[model samples]
Target: MTHPALIPGIGVEDTPRVFSTNWAVFGIAGVLVLGVVVWGFLAPDSISAAGAASLGWVTDNFGWLFSLLAIATIGFMFVVGYGRTGGIRLGADDESPEFSTVSWIAMLFSAGMGIGLLFWGPAEPLAYFTDVPPGFTAEPGSRDAMLDALAQSILHWGPMAWAFYALVGGAIAYAAYRRGRAPLISAIFRPIFGERTEGWIGAVIDVFAIIVTLFGTGVTLGMGTLQIASGVEVVTGIGPLGNAGLIVIITILTAAFVVSAVSGIKRGIRALSNINMVIAAVIGVFIFIAGPTLFLLNMIPASVSAFFGELWTMLLRNPAQGNDAAAFMASWTNYYWAWWISWTPFVGMFIAKISRGRTLREFVTVVIVVPSIVCIVWFGIMGGTTMLFESQGSGIADAGSPEAILFAVFGALPFGVVLSVLAMISIILFFVTSADSAAIVMGSMSQRGKPEPSTWVTITWGVLLGAAALALLLAGG
Candidate 1:
């Protein structure tokens, strides 16, 4: 990377020469994010295909590396949490927590995995039920397969994934708050280049972080759009929406969240997070009560046991071993890991923002333990309902489209349309929470990691996210 230490003092607030808010960083990062969106808009097929190709090659060639990194994440956190460093706070010794424990955990959990769980809670189990991986689980459509489906879903979203996110979050928070540095990726590399983290070298690192944030935010909006659009069609008993319909949904969502971004965190993010969590919990409870209540309750133990029992196989299985296993790993395991990594920059930063004043031990425990519990219960209820629904000949397991599976699960219940509408609204709100936080974080990075960035900057990032989402939808995201 380029080192511009020759042209600057420490790159922080009050230093006119600090590269943290330099025009070069903003100009380069902005152009990169906007350029990708515009290119995808104008030439979506090629851009989308190229992205797929690059990711595909990485999965095929470096499957072991991703798996190693993921497994290592678990070990890394244990070391941090169990060692003496566990007692260290993320912020200064005298600084108290800004939010209560409950509110803090709620916001982080919502941003970390709310939309994902909404999108995947029903779909992944159903998908696994349709086609369990060879040697990893039993035959599809069997009782054993049902157990494996829930187990696999929990594993994918379980502690391993959360640990990966915590690793990044802890690093950023330690660098920014504890060390009194800007919340930039370059700050994390202080051990290697202590003073140069404030130069163009740091700016280059921040630029990559910005691009990752942009992609994660944009693709998240697009995928959430697809799910809700299909959901609305199912609930209203209308035909599938065309591209124009999807565009309208995106536009409205963009506007609502942008308004929320400008409304400030209290009026926007915190409110949405609390409300969405209640709606999601209600939806989960309804599914459990109305559907197979006892079967899902029974799954809680079996799923957790299976995940721990088979953690090694699931962690290490890859395409290099055999054809069937390879294809399965490539699609499911590889997809999940890559998706989570892309989300780390923005999601981890959000986690960091809300995670100040907590010890490393407390933060790691909450991040890994709470989300893992939520996901297992979520999959157990949602996935177990799918199995019960399928037993009655609903064909929910064969829905083919993942986005449609949640609505299909709700279709079996009495007042199915009403249930589906609840799901749709909850999902939109969950997505809005993510978009709003990402916009604020992106603006924060562009402006020297201010806790609250300018409204105009936040709106600019939100609008850019909308455009990217629309373009990516066109590009087959």
Candidate 2:
């Protein structure tokens, strides 16, 4: 029955009021902007150079280590589910009308999917189709090519990937709800160290998780925002907004997300999630029915078969020769694993918060299966359509990147202008939801299990993320 520590002199209920102070939030925002400006002027080259160096180090030394660690973490969840006391149960007794099955599903999908689906769905399949990774290949635009693309994308977003998040989420949820512990990464070590996780060790873990999450999720937010900006450029035929446009977009979006987050999970996160899901479904349906429907239908079975046939080999394959396979592994697989790991802290925490009332089995199924399925379908429809179009020799070149593929696919559709507009809007909302969720997680981390961090802390993280993204963008330049 331990409750969140209250601010001195403030009633427990009044904590939210203190936490929501506009002045503090704005001040933090100012610091964030100032940091970004300083970085822009003084260390522009260092930003991208550092990112490249860091990425190189991870790929060269720690790529396999991350994969193995991720696998081990997943294994731990099954042990916990089977051996732990009380097994897994649904819903907390204290909360009013805990997240319903539907709401839970929506929140998970929105938070997990982000804008990656919109950007990667079409391009990744096409990448696999053309180059094919080390373990699998098919003639460009051939039936096999299309299937291979879908299969690989699914494999990337499949059980193992979702399991990574589920393990972390399960660990956090178990510690917080089952053990009456705080929601922090240190809780994962409680089984090993007991109360020793409470002092400096816990603080270090919390801080590490916060910093990693900030950078990782910030990279994602930047990527999503860039996509939105690109989508805007595509639809409106506007000149590049350069770095200034990126800052403006981030500022406006951050404000919207903060408000949604402050409104609490029910009214804000839930509502926005449902709306985003509906929009996503509508977009998927449009692609399925209007784009190469028959081709897409045929591709699924073939892809599933190919994926199964190559699953093990693909997972284990690491090309020693410096060729397409190596590039694919480095660019796609390695980068994705890092991104997922980076995202675990924020997404895992958010998932744990909403997953309070579910069994271990239910949590695993929903968190891993539902979102993975959504990713597969999304890639199938969008990616499948891109292959169909490219095969027909429609003068549509392979979109060098995932972001490019989204614009290409949407541009080819009937009422292309309208659909692209709506898609852009949806991307903005999706980015906000993601940024807000990360902000909340970072806020919680800063406060060390305080349900919500001070407004200043939340805003500070938001601005820093935005600044980091700007640095990455400048580094690319």
Candidate 3:
């Protein structure tokens, strides 16, 4: 292993420290996350209400800040990746990447946005088609609605979103690999905080990282479980899975992630991420070939073009448009921006860990550009096929719920059951890969940025994440 090159005067030791856990951060963050879970268990109503109130207050007041930060972060990534520092390697000058280029991209793609793309691939576009955004005058279900729907959907899952990940991930990678700092969120601030980073200031920064990561992963965990339940209903002809069933699903998948995490990154995360990517590609190809082949092929480039064309309008949209526009922003754009920001700690740290030995330009390009392209193509095929069906008066836009939309689209295709089953498998594997990396990241954080945290610490975080997901579902989040 290449030793981390510690920057002098930052207070990090020249030699790596061996410790079971960094008690301050571990105990504090763990207690807080557990506290929320306990509160949810005991008073689901109150906790959910409090959470909703908090979210509303933040979005209503700071929504503009979120939007500004998103656009600015995108610009920042470009400048850093292409500026004077662009060619700087994240680690020792001569060090090559620990993982191959293919594996690197697969792991980052899987951990960063894999599950989300699958969940919203069809639902988001169909949503905008049925109910167009305020700025657009397109009639719902019209050809214009089809173009605007895709543009808006791509905006949400596109470059700006990944920029948040790149900003945090790139900064951390630079600090840890390039400067030889400990890989903690707070450690990145040594230039600002100096030795204070070793005190309560650093502790606070790390605590926030841990909490945000837990909740970010928890939200996805909840969404993935609901979708998996929907898949179960579609494939096995079972009825809706109530909270109890969701908990069961969480329990089984939580075990899978915890085990994978314990096996280490190279053996478990990389292998599973690669396999999941292949499965995802197969599903995308099947949709393109089996659904609306020519339409999907046509929409791919059109969607890419539409995304750029619609980018400025969507980003500039704020509360000024009207109450309807403000409501829309709060409900969608602002909410999504907040979700991506909150996820920075988790996704950012995981990417930084895997990104050592890459130049800043390479890091930024892959982290931002490649994933953005994949997202555009993905939504085009999944959403395009669904829109084609809807335009033909298939009533898929009125499908009872978003979770069921993907399955409904599949139901229209040949061998719908087989497609649904494959989707479920992809989702489960995504669940494992995301949660697995998150557990390891949390473990590393609590252990003061140890590259490989202890197995017990990893397991503790994994189990807690599962419990948190169950609590959120029980609370109707």
Candidate 4:
């Protein structure tokens, strides 16, 4: 294997330059956010409409492509995992006790489940309940409908999905730490191409990974911003802010997170993730107590049965011609799968960073099973409540917007304001955790394996991501 060219000031032994670069990039993005917020206040509808349009186009046209990429990526991970037994190592000193079994599992759950469980838990199941997609047929609001929704949601977030993230991570981690290679995409093909792989092939993979990471992370960031803004609108009746608002929020948030990431993993990312998990657990408990206990209890068995029955079919189902089936795939299955792949680089790097001491089986099982269980329970709690309320004639179903469903359900519950505040806090922390981790990974990749890259490079990616999200929001609007 060819050794990486060591930059004098930025070697494995040096303090990570990526962290510093991330700080500077964040500062710039902050200023841009302020400007966009001002624009949003002046012209909300136009900006929001643009963002919506862009998002629609992407989802409609490229949804299938994202699904295919995810499948391929997942397939690669399985192959690698089967071929190797030891855990994939990352970084210079293998002795670094970065990956504790508890932390490894905690970080994975936090990073992978951010806002997905919180936002989609209720909404997705409800959507599926109303109209059972492929692999099931049931009337909306019926017992069968609720079960179908939970089952489908679990399948979407299950072992298969988590496996994709673990696969990409395992591949990259093995190459970077085990083989003493630079943590770059080109390293993946080194086994096939020999030392010659570093020149063009490596460069292409690095660039491709960067592009995919940005788009994937951008979507998640955008959704996070939207959820927060929507919550704000609900509480204050300030009206919905448009795409410009989303850009401003995302930019500002990105800057803050980049600064946190630059501060290094132990002090920044870890702390944020820890807090995020606590908040999520609290929210889960709150929903369990506030929502219908009997309904949730009944839904689990039904969901489990429906899930197993449809698992294989859902995995292999590809609707080639029908609009309804295509819509189902694009909106739910395809979107979820793509989102998982898009998160691979960020989540993979984060997983690798924290997975230094774990065994392969430990890493795989935690990555795939733990998060899947969390997702399942989360959906059952939140989504179950929404279905219960709707079935009982609470009028939440009339709200119509999937994005608005969480807020609507929360609004109807007792102590709505307090719950909303709690929800908002959790939402903010979730995205912060995601943004901080993504910035760190992107910084590391850009700097070519220097755990922390230059502060400027880190911030540059942060601002660029914020800008791209803004552009997407405008296009979507």
* Top candidate (lDDT): 3
Clashing pairs in 1: 11-18, 319-326
TM-score of 3: 0.96
lDDT of 1 by residue, 10-34 (tens): 2233334342345666689888878
Worst 10 residues of 4 by lDDT: 4-13
lDDT value, residue 9 of candidate 4: 16
Q: Pick the candidate with the highest TM-score.
A: 3
In angstroms, the error of model 3 at 144 is: 1.3
Taking the tens digit of each residue's C-alpha lDDT, what string does model 3 give over 344-447?
99899999989988888999999999988888889999999999898898888666777888899999999889999989999999999999999999999998
lDDT of each: 0.80, 0.71, 0.88, 0.70
**What stretches of model 4 exceed 4 Å from their correct place?**
1-96
- Per-residue alpha-carbon lDDT of model 4 for 1-477, expressed as tens digits? 533311111213333323222233234334454455445555667767754676578777877676666567656655545445434334443355565566566677667768777778778887876777875667767878788788888878876689888887766665655556666665667889887655555555656666667768767766777788888888888877875567678767877877886787778767777777787888778878877877777776677777888776666656564677777886778778767877887788778777754555566667776777777778888888988888888888676766678889988788887777888888888777777777777777655656667777667667666665665555452
Between which residue pairs do clashes occur in model 2?
Answer: 90-357, 91-357
TM-score of each: 0.94, 0.87, 0.96, 0.83
lDDT of 4 at 407: 87
